[model samples]
Target: MTEPLGAYGSVVEMLEAAATRAPDHPALVCEQVELTYARYRDCVAALAADLARDGIGAGDRVGLLMGNSAQIAVATFGVQAAGAQVVPLNPAYTESELGPVLKDADLALLIHDAGLEELAGAAAPKGTRCLIVGPGARDLTQPTGAPPAPLSLPDPQTLSTLQYTGGTTGAAKGVDLRHAAVAVNVAQREALLPTGPDERVLAITPLFHVYAVAMGLYLAANCGGTLHIVPKFTAAAVLRDIERHRITFLSASPTIFQALLRDPAFAETDLSSLRVCSSGSSALSAEVLHRWEEATGCAICEGYGQTEAGPVLTYNALHGPRRAGTVGVPVPATEIEIVDTDTGLVPLAPGAAGEIRARGPQLMAGYRNRPEETAATLRDGWLYTGDIGRMDDAGHLVICDRKKDMVVTAGYNVFPREIEEVLFAMPGVADAAVVGVADDYRGEMLCAFVVGAEGDLPEERIRAHLAERLAKYKWPRDIRCLAALPKTAVGKTDKKELRQVASVPPSEPA
Candidate 1:
C-alpha cells in the first residue's frame, strides 16, 4: 500500500519490513498450514544463511522449479536475500522444454520441489548443486548456536530475476530485470488494485508467472495481507478454499475462469466474499465475462503486460470505468505510445493501430546474452512491445494483435484477435484461437481452431457467424474443431503450435 520505494529500496528490504511491521499476522497459507510473518521471516533467514554457506552469492543465477506453495515463497525471498538472481522454471515443463533454459542460463544452483527432483536433476548442468524441498526431501540445515548470517542486500541496479518470455511467438528469451524495477512493478499493481490488510488473496495460477507473483503473492505480502497458495489449480478445490478462507481477491487466466464457470458447484458456491477478479494471459470471451459477472457479482478486470516490462504495464480501473475489450490506462509512473512499426519514431494518432512502445521504472534492462535482440527491443529508454494496439480517446488501449501474428493475405492485413473475438461472441463457442497459415497463392491464409461447449461445432455455423461480422478476406479458410486449444506454460494460447498444425495437410488432426 505504500508508495513504490525509491532507488535505495530492494524487494528484500521491503519484505523484511513487512515481516518486522506485522510479525504476528498470517503471511502465507497452503492447505491446512499457515505461517505467521515472524515464522516466514525466520525460515527465509535460515535458508538465506544456508544458501550463502553453499557459496550462492551476488550475481549468481539460481533456478527454482517448484509448484505454487509456501515453499516457493520461502525459496524466492531466501534466494534473493542471499543476493542471487532467481530463474523460475515451470513445474510442469518436460525435460525437453526445461533443458535448453537450464543450459542457456548456466545456473549456479537448482532448487526444486521433492515431487520434481528427478526432472530438475535431469535439467541441471552437471556441476550445479541441487536443493530439494517438501516432505522427504533433502534437509536445508543451518547451525543452531550462531546467529543467522546477515543478508547481502542488492542495490537498485542489481539483477533480481531472469524472467523468460512466454514462447507463444518464437523461442523464449531471458529478460534481465533489476530489483528496483521489480519492486516498482509490484507497487504499480498494488496502486491499481488495492487490497486491504485483512484481505485474503487466492493465488491459483503458477507462482512462477510474473502476473501471479505480482498480483497475488507480492501484493499480499506488501499490503500485510494473507496469501492462500494453491499448489495447482482445481476448480472444486479453489471454490472450497474461497468459501473456507473468505478469499477477497483472485487472479487467474481466462481458461481457468472458464473452467470454474463450468464446474458443477459454481452456482451454489459462496463467492460473496470475493471483491475482485483479474483476468489475463489471454482474451476473456464476452460470454464467459457476462456469465461470471452475473453469477458472482464481481467484475473481471483485464490487464496487459509482457516479460520485458517487469510483466505489468496497465490494468482496468478499479474505481472508475472498466472496459470489456480494452486493457485500461497505463499504471502510475509509466508511459505508453503507439508508433510506426518500421520507423519506431512516428507516433500514431488516436485510435490508429500500431506497435505499442512503453517506458517505465519497471522496464527490464535487456535480454540476457542476446545483445542484438536486446538492441532491437530496447530503443533509447523505451521498450518496443511487439504487440499491436490502438488507444481510444479515453486513454484505454485495445490490443489488435501481435505484429508477428498478423496475417497478410491478398494485400490485406488481418489480425487474429479480431476474428477470434467474433468467434468468442458466438453462442456455442467455448474457446477459439486464430493463426495464419502459409498459402500457395495468397501468401497466407486464416485458420480458426475452436472448442465448442458440447459436441463438435459445425464448420458452416462458424463460417456463417464470421461472414456476418467480418469481411470475406478476414474469414477463416480452414476450421479445426478440438476438445481444447493448446496453451503455453503461462496459460496463453500456443499460437506457435497452432501454426505448425496449420502447416500440415488437412487430413492430419491438430
Candidate 2:
C-alpha cells in the first residue's frame, strides 16, 4: 500500500523519500543523459547548498527562467530544498516582457539558462543577482561547494511556488501554492492516471507552467518513474523520441496532439508501449481526439483545471468509460459544482451552464500580494474558477468557454469556443480563434482568425458551414486566414492578441 504523503511537510521531503526508496532508479532522462535517483538527489543537495550560501531561505523568492530541460527539474528541487519559493519565468520573454515579472516578484536571485544571460541581465531589477544554469557559467546545475547538510523540513503551509496564472485575460497574477497543496495536487493527478515505479513518462510541455509541474515532474518523481524531458516541442522530434524511448505515458496539450497527427511519421511510428495520453491547457477538439485514438489505439484523456486549482480538477478515467470532449469526473478527494454565475451561491441543476467552482486540498493558498483578487477568487474554501462550463446528465464536465471569452453581441451571449469547435471540425482549418470586435450595427461583431493546414479555405464555404448550424447572431462577421494563430507563452491560442488584430480594418484588395 502507498503510505499517506500528507505527513511530509514539504515537497523536498517527499522527493527525498522517493530518492531514498529508489536510489538506483532513473529519475530523469534528457536525450542521452540519464540521472539516477541517487545522483539527482546529490545534485539537488549541492545546489541547495549553493543557494543557502547565497542567503535564499524560507519565503525568499528564487526566480527560474529557462525552457524545459534536466536543469529545470534539478533547479526546481534544489530551490525548494533550500526552503525558498520558486518563481518560474518564461525564457521566451524578451526584456520588456520579463521585466514586470522580475520587478513584481522582487526576487533575491534570478536563476536563468546560460543562453539567456543577456536577456536576464536586461530584465532583472537593479541589485537582483543572476545565477546561470545549463552547460556553461554556472550555479545550481554545477556546484563548486560541498554538499549542504540536510535542512529541517518546512511547515506544511510554507509557500512552495508562486506560479503566475496565464495572462489570457490580463496581467498575470502570482498564485501562492503551499507545500501541502502541491503535494495534494500531485497525488490527485496520480489517482486519476495511476502509474507504477517502472513507468516511463515523456513530457513535452513546458515545466514553467503549473500543469506540467504537477502532472509531469512531481507525478513522475512521486512514483519514482523515469521521465524523458524534451527541452522544446517539435512534432517530428517528439514522435521520434516517443518511439525511441518506448514511453508508456504522455502529458501534453491538444495543440501538440494535433501537430503529431499532422506529422507523416506519426502514422508509421510504433506506439504499442503507450498506456495513456493526457491532454490539457486547451480544449481538445473532437476531430483531433478521434484521429489520435484511431491512429495510436490509446485514449487521449482530456482534463480541466487552472493554475490556482492545483492545476487539475477533473480527468477522464484510465480504466472506466473515457469521453472525448468532456474533461470527465473530478479526481478523488475533490468536489466540483456548477454554480449560477450571477450569485455564485446556488448550485445549478445538471446540464445547466454556470461558473465552475472547485474545492480540494490541492487548491492554492491565494493570489500573492493581491488580497482583493484573492478574496474574489477563493471564497469560503471554494476556488471560483472563472471558466464557464456545464455538467452533462452523466456527470461529466464540459468546458464551454472562459467567462471573459464570451462575446456579448446584440442581446445574445456567443461563446467563442462554440464557434472555434465548429471551425476545428471543418476540413483544412488547422487552428481557429474567435473574438468580439467593435461595431455599431450589433454592439459587437464576432470575428474569426484561422490557420489552414493545406491552404486558404474558401470564405464562402466557412460561412455556409456556420450558417447551417448557428443562429445569425452567433455567426462570425469576418474570417481572416493566417499561417498560424498567435500563441501565449504556455501555448494556448492567444485570443487576447487576436482581438487586437480583429480591431484593425482590412485594406482594399490590391
Candidate 3:
C-alpha cells in the first residue's frame, strides 16, 4: 500500500524519503542525460550547499529564468532544498516584461540562463546576486556530492514558492504557497496520474508554470517515475521522443494536443506505450479532444486550477466517466462553491452560471507582500476564483468564462465563450479569443483574434462563417487573423496583452 504523504516538512524531506525508498531508480531524464535517485539526491544536496554559500536561505525568493532542462529541474529542487522559495520567471519575459515580477518579489539572487544574461543584467536589482545557469553559466551541473549547508530556516509552514498569476490584472502579484499547501496539491496531482517506478512521463510543457511542476516533478517524485524532460515544446520533437522513451503519460494544454494531432507522421509514430493524457491551462475544445482520443486510442482527462491555489482545484481520475468539456469534480480534499457576485455562495438548483469559489487545504498562503490584494482574493478562507462556471446534476464543473472576460453589450450579458464555442464549431477556425474593445455606437464591441486553417482566411469570410450560427450582436465586428495567438504562461491566449498592444496610441498620427 502507498503510504499517503500527509505533511512532509520540505523538498529535502520529500526527496530524501523518495530516495531512501528507491535509490537505484532513475529520477529524471532530459535529452541524453539520465540521473538515478542516488545521483539526483547528491545533486540536490550539493546544489543546496552552493545556494546557501551564495546567501539564499529559507523563504528568500530567487528567480528561475530558463527553458525546460535537467538543470532547470535540479535548480528548482536545489533552491527548495536550501529552504528558499523559487519564483519561476517566464523565459519570454523581457527586462521590461520581467520588471513587475522582479519588483513585486523581494528577490536578491537570480539564477538565469546565459541566453538571458543581458536581460538579467538589465533587470537585476541594485545589489542582486545573479548567477547564470546555461551554457556559459558558472554554476556547475555535475554534482560534487556535498552535505547541505545549514541556515536558520523557518518552520515548514513558511512559504516555499511565489507563483505569479497570469495577466488580466494590471500589476501581477505573487501567490505564496506554504509547505503544507504544496504537499496537498502534489498529492492530488499524483492521485490522477497512473504511473509507477519504472514508467517514464514526458515533460513537454513549460516547467516554469505550475501545471508542469505539479505533473512533471511532484507526480514523478511520488511514484518514483522517470521524467523525460524535453528542452522546449516542438510537436515533431515531442512525437520522436515519445516513441524513443516509451513515454506513458503526456501532460499538456489543448493547443499542443491540436498540433500533435496535425503532425503527418503522428500515425506512424510508435505510440504503443502511451497510457493516458491530461490537459489544462486552457479549455480543450470538444472536437480536438474527441479526435485525439480517436486517433491515439488513449484516455485524455481534463484538470483545472490556478497558480493561487497551488494550482490544482479539480482533476479527472481514471475511474470516473470523462465528460467532453467539464474540468471534472473537485479533487480529493478540495471543495467547490458557486456564488453570485452580490451575495455569498447560493447553491444553484442545477445548471446555473455563477462564480466558482473554492476553499481547501491545497490553497496558497496568500499573495506575497501584497496584503491588501491578498486579503481581497483570499477572503473568509475561500478563493473567489474569478472564473464563471456551473455544476451539473452529475457534479462536473463546466467553466463558461472568466468573470472579467465575459462581454457585456448594453445591459445584456454576452459571454465571449458562447460566441467562441460557435466559432470553434465552424470548420476553418483553429483557435479564437474574443474581447470587448471600445466603440462609439455600442457600449463595447466584440472583437475576435482568430487563428485559421493554413490558408488565406479573410475577415469577411470569418464574419460570413460565424453569421450563420451567431446573433448579430455577438458576431465579431473586428476579426483579425493571426499566425498564432499570443499565449500567457499557462497557455491561454494572452488577451489582456493583446488588448494592450492593440490599443497602443496610433503612433501620434505619424
In terms of TM-score, the best-performing candidate is 2
Residue 256 in candidate 1, Cα distance off native in Å: 1.4
What's the best-to-worst order under lDDT? Answer: 1, 2, 3
The 10-residue segment with the lowest total lDDT in model 1: 138-147
In candidate 3, position 336 carries an lDDT of: 89
How do the residues 1-510 of candidate 1 rate in per-residue lDDT, one tens digit apiece?
Answer: 465444225677767777778889998899766788777777778878778888887879998898888888888888888888999887766565577788888888899988886777776778778888888874332224455644557777889999876333335578898988988888887677776778899998888877788788777877778999998778899999899999999888776787788899898899999999988765566677888999999988888988799888999978889888898889889999999988989999999999999999999999888898889899999999888999999999998877756665543446787678788999999999999976644556889999999978999999998886664767889999989988999999999999998888779764
Question: Which stretches of candidate 1 lie above 4 Å from their native place?
Answer: 4-8, 139-152, 166-169, 405-510
Q: For residue 33, what is the lDDT in candidate 1? A: 66
Full-model lDDT for every candidate = 0.81, 0.81, 0.75
Give a tens-digit lDDT track for model 2, residues 184-257.
77777777778878888998888997778877888787888898999888989999888998899988876678
| Residue pairs with clashing backbones, model 3 | 58-83
TM-scores of all models?
0.79, 0.80, 0.79
TM-score of candidate 3 on Cα atoms, chains taken together: 0.79
Model 2 TM-score is 0.80
> lDDT per residue, candidate 3, 256-312, as tens digits?
787788888898898888888888776777887888888888888998888888888
